[model samples]
Target: MNYFELHIGDYAEATQHLSILEDGVYSRLLRKYYASEKPLPADVAIVQRLIVAKSKEERAAVEAVLQEFFVLAEDGWHQLRCDGEIERYRSGEPERKAKKANEEERMKRHREERAELFTKLTAAGAHAPWNLPIKELRERVAALPAIVSGDEPATPATGPETLQVGEPATAPATPATATQTPIPNTHYPDTNTQTPTNIGINTPLPPKGGRKRSREPVEEPQGFVRFWAAWPASKRKESRGKCAEVWVREGFEALADVIVAHVEAKRDQTDWAHDGGQYVEAPMVYLNSRKWEGAEVGAMHQRKREVVI
Candidate 1:
């Protein structure tokens, strides 16, 4: 358990009577206990050395904190609060396992649906815009049949039709040689005196504040996609959108091969595998913290795998 919740009010009230040195010693001991997920050793010297209590004052502080906050039993020095937290964590293991199983099943169903859609698109000599979110992709997939079969009206070749969908359509232009009918301005209805130009037929008015620029989907690079596919799916694999953003911002496409190799290597590492990936860093966290440079990943391994691109 590398992480634990500390209630500030509860902690402060309990330790307010202790000196600064004693307070620091108490905090250190609690961290060690939670990290190891066990009670402190029976031997006081061993405990002191673990917290680096070298000086006489430091040693006394350790003793004082232990006396008030912990109880000695045959196994070790146990703190009731720490014990309760450990028990609660263990008790929730079954619930966590079930949740993980459900998520895996949901992902499997999505893959099957996507595969069916891909087949249809491929037959039509088209492919999905993988850059779009799943909801948008699903909608597009459903509409593809009507579009490809010509049952749906084709998009107009030019003018306002060229703009994004949902923009208001205008009256088609009249041929220069033909007689024209005067169409009333529906928007500005009090328009008997206005000329055709004043009707603003060619250009639509900007939406309330201003025209909103269309935001097209951004295509992800092949390198980043491969890197992501190679990365393991775990409980900590979260914030995918933010992770993709960071990958591009950091220009990690150049280091994709090296990064993927390191991730493969770490598949066997104890920290990532421990407690079913409870300690695995989130994808966004791994990129943001630049963990590839950490000593845990060898320089030799990364350098050997670096590509020219």
Candidate 2:
């Protein structure tokens, strides 16, 4: 086990009678026990080396702590409380892993279900719900049952109209034309007519005509779309708009490769994969937090090699 629970009250009660130095030594020994995931060495010299006890006072403290808290068992020197914690951790590990796996499987199924629904909606000619205004999307969804059932047509009739089956068609009579009356014409002067008086005033010629500066719509880049697709979905999925805004504002398009690489490298990390990925940040949150910007690619690789060595 890499970790063990240390209840403050229990710890204090156990070490209450020990001196401060003895308490420190006891704490160090407990850390070694958990870190090594085994019993401590029975030899005092080896134990001193493990706890880094050098000075005479420190050695004395170590001996006193061991006498008070540890037992010389058949295997080695063991702390009963530490042994109990280790037992609990070992016993619970399999159950914890099983639960995590089940949760991950459940989440995977949920994502597949959503993807299927999105495909169906798109095939039905409904605009992508993610791209539609929330109210409009809700209305479409509310009306989807009727549309799918064929009970209601896509377009409703405006008014009732019918054709008679047995009646013969009748021709309508034309109306008489009215006589025309002529009237005098009224003409208006053109606004651009020349002025009678010549004025010697210098006027700035109108700025040379040029093409209008029209701003084309900001299209979502393919890289961002790919990145979004690769990102694990979570409750913060709705924050995609905010994420896109940040991506544009920060000009993250050029760094898309870097972001993707960072995500790939960190995806399987304990922090990201823990709790069935519940700890993974939303795409927008991860980007806005600048997590991808600080990826230590070569450094991580070097550390991995060192660990293996």
Best by TM-score: 1
lDDT of 1 by residue, 126-149 (tens): 544332345665676667768664
Task: Kindly give the stretch of ten consecutive residues in candidate 1 with the minimal lDDT sum.
Answer: 300-309
TM-score of each: 0.47, 0.44
Model 2 global lDDT (CA atoms, 0 to 1): 0.65
- CA lDDT of 167 in candidate 2? 54
Q: Which sections of candidate 2 miss by over 4 Å?
A: 125-309
lDDT of 2 by residue, 62-115 (tens): 888888889998778998888887888789989989987997686566444433
Clashing residue pairs for model 2: none
lDDT of each: 0.71, 0.65
